[model samples]
Target: MKILIVENEIYLAQSIASKLSHFGFVCEMIPSVGEAMQMEAADIILLSANIPGQDFYPLIEKFKDSIVILMIPYVNEEMVMRPLKAGISDYIVKPFMIDELICKIEHYTAFRQLQKEIAFYRDYFCNSLLMPTYSINTKISFPLIIKSVSQKVIDMCVVNYAIHKKLAINFISLYKNHHYKEIFKSVSKTQLTYIIGFETLRKEEKEECVKALKNIPVIFACLGGDLHDFKNVFEINVKEMTHGFQEDVLSVDEYIKTMILKFEDKYPDTELSKRLGMSRKSLWEKRKKYGITKKK
Candidate 1:
């Protein structure tokens, strides 16, 4: 983690840097908020209210919405409250224990991350039409095309979150519940399929979803997938994948989400059974062995 400290105090900055460095964190010490403003790439910035010439309020404006924690010599309603409202992520009083400082750092850093993620999804919802389903006539555009613009913006915003930020993140937790969820009452919700086209998922993470995709009987048929082939496969044994819960197969809106994780890394799904881990005849026998019945 690259931690930025914008404190004019020389010795205090060095001491804080040393403390943070002991824990394998890279610390960048800049005496003034002005200089710190120049290196805007810092992951976390610790600002001081008691700086020379400049107040910390405007720095909050300069780096608006950044995960900046303010450190002050003293704390009161007036000082702490104002910065908090002015977009300071969290505030710390000077002469505090190192442990407390670190704890506060961890707590607020997590909160800031969550806020950013929520903002990202909100932006996505705003840019994209959250229609339940896009209907198509003969030779109509793929539904995913309409959503491509919004998805790109959201993914771009969150692209450089961290090394592993590409891992699957539940979109439900990011967005608030809607008023009319049951509006899909008429639609037969089967297996959730992420029918997206624009994004790419690392094979590994995509495969991870496939592994977790068990118990729910999900499938990943791309737009180019043979609809009839998939249908034939489904007609043969719908119950095989469903594990008997075929009626309530759910979450297709997120089905293909893992695919959007990252494009640079090529990771294969490590957990899917090898060839379903059985020979064709063996699979047939096991269906009988398990006393499973095909529904379609």
Candidate 2:
């Protein structure tokens, strides 16, 4: 990382540069803010706040994106607070330990990196949810429950709804073993919360979850089953099929019944039986047992 040190004290600047160079930092020393501004870009700016005749605010504005650490002679609001409020990263009192200065630099560096990463991910998540095909019903209000056969469909709907409303979503998946009681206790009343895998909870647990989330602003997406007893919650059942296969694993009988019913019109009985790895007679017997009939 490149560091620009703006200090009139030549010896102090050289000492700082020499020590930082040992740690693999590219250091450039300038006597004034004017000279510092004339230099190339730097990852960090170590600006002396007590420069006799130089105005430091211009330098701060120039390197606003860079990590700016003030080197102040004394701790006072006049020398420190104004720059800090103007977006200076941090300040160190003069004659401080080199280790302490390095520690501060590392902390702010990591913090700036974290901020960038958070911004990138926030934009990515929002852009991913902004789909033109998915439509959100704005008439429906919050504290809603969505019932769907497919979890993917529910996810798409909720995400699209959040984007439509221009509200940020705090997503919690019950499948991840999150405690419902804790989730309820910590739920944000300001932001919109989306709770997925509601059907994964037991019937008694569902009742408890419903009770806990009663007053919270949440959108519950139940992958299967219905929360019929939950009062004052708006329920939406989406019947549309998403682009992928169902997430829920089906029993052999259920799988066979669904496949036969779906493909009976598309393919003949012989082909369908062959695809299912069964004889026509066995397929017929299975269909009769499952009470599934081919529509004429």
Candidate 3:
């Protein structure tokens, strides 16, 4: 990473640049805020608040996007608090060890990276699951089984559960690994295990797998049909709500029925029917056939 040292003390700037360069950091030194402002962009900015007659706030604002740390002679309103409010990431006392500064740089770099990743995944999840919202059952207990017609429904339920519980999900697909049982032994107790592709296992294998997970905190996503063998099974009916097209194949009639059920309330008959590629009469007939009640 590139480091910009904006300190008026020439000797101190050279010492810091030399120490940081030894640790694989590209260091640039400038003696004033004016010169530093004109310098090229850097990943991190170490601005000394003690620069004589220079208003360091302008430099702080200029490099607000970078990890700007104040090299303060003493901690007070002008040096630490005000710069922090103005977007300086942190401050280090003078005469500090090089290792301590490196530690702060590494720490904030990881933090900023995590912020970027969170932003990306949040947008990704929002786009992937565009319609339908899910809530965890109040009576939900760990080591549960979620039975749903659509894989997407089960996925939303598990994702919502993990988020609500503030736990990370350790996803495991049975089709991909026959020895998934071994994962349970080594899995972190803090993470929630979300298991899919259980239908690929044999009857005996399913039974053994269930026994092995008896004491582990896990949620099984069983696609289609009610699983009678397991207790604490939560069924999410696909008919109750719809999320448009899905990974699972549906008959033409079923698809039409799901579409009407999902959009009937949201759109008028003329718009809804046109979108479904059918006339208002056919929409009425399909609603009748599927026994779906249209809201007044």
lDDT of each: 0.49, 0.75, 0.76
Per-residue accuracy of model 2 over 71-177 as CA lDDT, tens digit each: 99999889888999888999999988899999999999999999998687656545643233345554554467776554455566676677677888898766564
Per-model clash counts, in order, read 9, 0, 0
lDDT of 1 by residue, 51-169 (tens): 86786666788776567888888878888898878877787888777898889778877887888887876565444432111111123211111122233322322222211233232
Ranking by TM-score: 3, 2, 1
Candidate 2 vs candidate 3, lDDT winner: 3
Per-model TM-score versus the true fold:
0.46, 0.57, 0.65
Q: Candidate 3 has which clashing residue pairs, if any?
A: none
Candidate 1 colliding pairs: 192-252, 193-252, 194-255, 194-256, 200-259, 201-259, 203-267, 204-267, 204-268
Query: Under the 3 Å rule for N, CA and C atoms, how many clashes does model 3 have?
Result: 0
lDDT of 2: 0.75
The ten-residue window of minimal lDDT in model 3 covers 126-135
- Candidate 2: how many backbone clashes? 0
On TM-score, the leading prediction is 3
